[model samples]
Target: MPELGLDTLKAALPEYAKDTKLNLGSVLGNGQLPEQQLWGTALACAIAAGNATVTAELAAEATDRLKPEVVRAAKAAASIMAMNNVYYRAKHLIGDPEYQSLPAGLRMTVIGRPGVDKVDFELWCLAVSAVNGCGTCLESHEKTLREAGVPRGTVHDALRIAAVVTAAATTLSAEQALG
Candidate 1:
């Protein structure tokens, strides 16, 4: 197989997905975040978007730009948030006070000891949560980030990356399915 990256993905997009291609370029070029946070958010959101091609490309790019531990943490954020988003979203939507009192019982030790910085991991999780549409998780992560002194603009940039990555993945998947 040929190498897949952002350029390859962009080129593969159909005419109707032009907005996604443009947004992908703009969001990835955002300067509000440090390299680690920006790329980590991109990689985590790619995994959360559930496209093998996008994930592979972003993972390769992230590996080239981020340290090994940072890459691992980004993946962990994606994996853990996948479960958390579903569970927490359901719990919040159910509106059962009992569920709130009960323990999550999930093994999420990674959130505490993610090899990367806590705030960066939280940001990545926030990005994934945004893609997953878990408002509870988004609010929780955003609050944590804000408390940690992360600027709103930085958080917004991460969400923008997540939004564009998810859109690109969905567009690609739709095109592949229709073809």
Candidate 2:
């Protein structure tokens, strides 16, 4: 299989710094998360970050390893988290008991029929939630993954991918703006 290289994206960054390269290497390696989960989570977080370069790079790397359904699940997770993170974070930050009691009323049918393994989709959601900084979604997805017997190491590695991808996206975006 081909390697996941951030060659082009790195070129857009400031001198292709060591830390970003190392983090990419660590997450892209065959680590705790299965290859599919690693790539899927990376893609979802990339989408959440909304960096075209990173998103395209991750999508290209993920295309072969991930089944179409899995890719869809990743996209779905990012989309849903984009909406949910805003709502839930507001609720949490506002500290309004009434808001907590109110229904979200958002259609999240994709969560039930994600077109991929439910646990895998949940993992993607968890990763995106991490990037979005949604405490509520993070707790819910983490609980679901744990109940489904997902190892903490796997979860940690997925979060690592999310963190690295997010940082890379931010770096690339700043480079684009500055250039």
Specify the highest-TM-score model's number: 1
TM-score of every model versus the real structure: 0.95, 0.92
Query: Which stretch of 10 consecutive residues in model 1 shows the poorest summed lDDT?
Result: 1-10
- Pull out the clashing pairs in model 2: none
Off by over 4 Å in 1: 1-4
lDDT of 1 by residue, 1-179 (tens): 76456777777778988998888877785446889999899999999999887888888888989999899899999999999999999999999889998899999999999988999999999999999999999999999999999999989999899989999889878877888
What's each prediction's clash count?
0, 0
- Candidate 1 whole-model C-alpha lDDT, 0 to 1: 0.90
List the RMSD of every prediction in angstroms.
1.8, 2.1
Which residue window of length 10 is worst by lDDT in model 2? Answer: 2-11
Off by over 4 Å in 2: 1-7, 10-12
- In candidate 1, which residue pairs clash? none
